[model samples]
Target: MTETQTTAEAVTTTRPTLLEARDLHVEFSSRGRRARAVDGVNLAIGEGEIVALVGESGCGKTTLARTLLGLERPTSGEVRYDGNPLTYTSKALKTYRRQVQLVLQDPTGSLNPRHTVYEAVAEGPRIHGLPDEQDLVSKALSHAGLRPPDRFFLRYPHELSGGQRQRVVIAGALALNPKVLIADEPVASLDASVRGEILALLLRLRDELGLSALVVTHDLGLAWNIADRVAVMYLGRIVESGPVEQVLTAPRHPYTQALMSVLPESPERVVLTGEPPDPTRIPGGCRFHARCQVLASGKAAEAGVHTRCRTEPLPILPATPEAQAACYYAETTTP
Candidate 1:
């Protein structure tokens, strides 16, 4: 077998589950209409596994991440940690957050301009009432690549470069010494050169600390670089998921294929047509049927699954460890 295949197979695991979502759902009510930001979905992050959640904006990836982080309460269903269902009590949630920290999209906005580097990194430990704030802060900063940690003790958000600001945000989460990091677009704001640095830090942390992560991003390139497994979201559900290399290189779902086709410098590009329907008025059957290239090109009909694709929902089926897709046509034909 080739080196790439060997590497891909290495990540296909049945490790003990660390975090899980069982039929998770989250909804928002507005102007007499309800938006299902996160519809019925199930996902798991194995201990020491790095799973990337990929999707376009407004596709509920963020809502899913927030719900998993205990920041958003689901309308129904449950989020579980180590076999226990999530509880909404303030004390319980607070303790949960200490183990699963979030690194937001924007570093500048996430950090207060008034706070110094030391103060920013120290905040998490303080909030959790953890002891040895100074030591935790110093170690977190160093771990995040801000070495000679004392040198940055007095620097403000504006004083550091964009990459440094992001590192500070990461350090804050690290001070809590989280086992799981839910990083939403961690390197989105950094320049190309700096993006690599931040990504490297995340990988190192995962290897050295045995930290698992849920990296939420739209970039397939980033997922290929960092994730072991990947879940592709559409509208309010995970339509496809599996090992990253398998999904990225041989995506079976039509939506996932469209996404991969457009990766920078990819040989072919699939430009999708039309805006995603309003979340409040999500379409029936397949949420992606309306935008599906398979349906548009008559392939689903050719395969004898088109009508079913438009009138019935398909569950995400992992026929094998390498792949899964919530598409009747893809599943039937993906031998």
Candidate 2:
């Protein structure tokens, strides 16, 4: 296979971290109550690594992504690029934004209906006041697989297919020569056939450009398809994280295990009794204990498991050198 060929086993490695979030917390207030979207979250993305942040809808993944990009200020904690805290000054922020690009979930909404593909892709360079705008736009379009770049230059968004539109959006991001890309549900809006193509294009971009990415989605299959590592978020926190294979195959946290159990190919099916607990009123002690089967079935209480499960929240601790989970019984429970 060629070096850029993507297969079942995707390439991934941990070099120095390029972007990181330390104890990040983002909260919003509504009617006198504060909602903790991202609560004390810590994450790191090594150069060239694809880390998939997976969870159900409203699990704070998108909020965390925005914080990492410096789009939203955290209630507390900090975001760092190349080990340095992000700067908030206008010039600094402009430079930082160029290095960290965001690919929105909806390509149609992201691209203006009135703008041609060339105009859309050229906007970044124009904003940055860069010369050689045409070269940058053409190269970005080509890199994003909009081959014969000239062919699509004059086409408007409505004239393109979903996959083509997404590629155009990606091309626009590439126009800035970004070091990292934060894609939110990149394939959720594409057809099944087109989804594979877009994913392949992303993998190719990583292999060819040495770009790092944080893919936020609920699809475990997508993680398996391209990501080297996976982080499972729940109720504003990372409940489990590790190499994709280890986390998907032998998940430690009950929440992680339950998620994996429901896959069409999973050997066991874990069906929790109720919907996820309200984020504004997240349960005390173990956040998941309210619906955790081990505790609910009386097994944990009978075995006299860690009493902390009934009195204090558990912090995510390492299960292996490369993995971590945030459950009191993560190491002992079968899930």
Candidate 3:
């Protein structure tokens, strides 16, 4: 199918459940130590929603993306595309690969130094054996806001600025006419000014192309600005997730609140104590208890909180119809 036709078809069709991950567990084994990077992460992305996975470094956001893309195999749990289990050798995997593309944070590093911009964008369609490579590359470049697309076609990666390189990376992904786009810290490397521009580009692409996206970032401000929904990850688990406004305005999980409080204010700053616990040796009960001010505030301790926070695992329960948090106190506590 032509790129235009494929895009149009995706738009006209009722929004499909593009991706679903349930109880995903990814582990790394080394020298008698097993580290679970993603611990039972359950998430879904509809056809056109932009879901942001926000967390500190080493919280497994990148690992989750790799698992979803079939780059890394999960030790347990399932990743599905369009309701079927995703396997490396399955036909669905190839189809999913063609329909889902990723934009990495470091565009310069991600793009091959040897390949020109045109070659980079055309690579996806060429590898997938899609007909009409010329048209697809042209459309991709245009869609990515690289005006006079032909001007950039022959330029090497080193020739472009950081923002331009990122634009090229985005164009390469768009070339596939992907149904789902997973951007792993797409703006982390850019200048402050360019970050907004790239974010605006992503937003425009979502609106104009009707693309669903899973954006992984450590920046809550970025998530608040661009994501439709946000999932907060802590210690390899999703501690809280909900609509962007609800989660940001009134976070339920203590970890989420701590993260929100750390956002820079003009004159006031909220100090967070302690460091995130080691994933390899995760603390019992609530993984965040040591750093949670609320939990340390005598009230939680006096409420006869006997189980866990030091022993048992807590269930992720619904805080409201639209939101859920992996904390026993989420439903009862008002944030």
> Model 3, range 311-331, lDDT digits (tens) per residue?
666764221226778775664
Compose the digit string of candidate 2's lDDT tens values, residues 1-335. Answer: 22112122211335777888777789998668888898777778988989999998888999999899888999887788987889788888999989999998799999999999999999999999999999999999999999999999999999999999999999999999999999999999999999999999999999999999999999998998989889999988888988999889888877887888878999888888887777778777887887788777776667676476777767643212277687767656544
Backbone clash pairs for candidate 1 read: none
1 against 3, candidate with superior lDDT? 1
Model 1 lDDT per residue over 65-121, tens place: 999999899998788887688899999999999889999989999999999999999
The better candidate by lDDT, 1 or 2, is: 1
Each prediction's TM-score versus the true structure: 0.94, 0.92, 0.90
CA-lDDT, candidates in order: 0.87, 0.85, 0.82
Best by lDDT: 1
By TM-score: ranked, best first: 1, 2, 3
lDDT of 3: 0.82
Q: Candidate 3 has which clashing residue pairs, if any?
A: 285-309, 285-310, 285-311, 286-309
